[model samples]
Target: MPSSDDVYSQLKDCVSEITKIPRGEITLNDSLSGDYGYKDGPSRRSFAISLERCFKKHGMTIPKKLDRDKMEEAKKLKNVRDIVFTAFGV
Candidate 1:
């Protein structure tokens, strides 16, 4: 199994790609829209979906409840770190 840190790193990398947010610019205190230019809530939703696709590509699956909650709570994540920690449990 991958370590939590590894998972977090992967998530961060993939999220960066999906959100068009640069690595250094991503923080735990930034909202996807305000920080990453996500114009609407659906963009954040798509981010989560992209994350799930990434996870599935790696032969993993985020728990359904957690996935749903992650999708719902995307805007509340303080930064990239917060999202990674919450979703991947790092």
Candidate 2:
């Protein structure tokens, strides 16, 4: 498992890279879709997939992509905390 610090740090970096919103501005409350525009399709999938590499780089293991085909299941992950909690279970 990735240390909590690694998860947050890497997640901040990823959000910054994906949303172009600078890491300093990123917050746990920011909605992955509403704030970052990761609504569906390639964007969300890419983010999920990228997390796999990010966590791996930190020597942690999480599913490569929690790509939920069902909209209802997918909708549950709305923010940084949601994504990290669901993906890392920590």
Candidate with maximal lDDT: 1
Candidate 2 lDDT over 1-39, as tens digits, reads 666677677777765665579888777666656776777
Whole-model alpha-carbon lDDT for candidate 1: 0.61
lDDT of 1 at 33: 65
Candidate 2 Cα lDDT to native: 0.61
Compare the candidates by TM-score and give the number of the best one: 1
Model 1 lDDT per residue over 1-90, tens place: 557667766666666767677877665566766666665657666666777787777666654424544555566444434555565555
Compute each candidate's TM-score over C-alphas. 0.61, 0.59
Q: In model 1, what lDDT does residue 13 have?
A: 65
TM-score of 1: 0.61
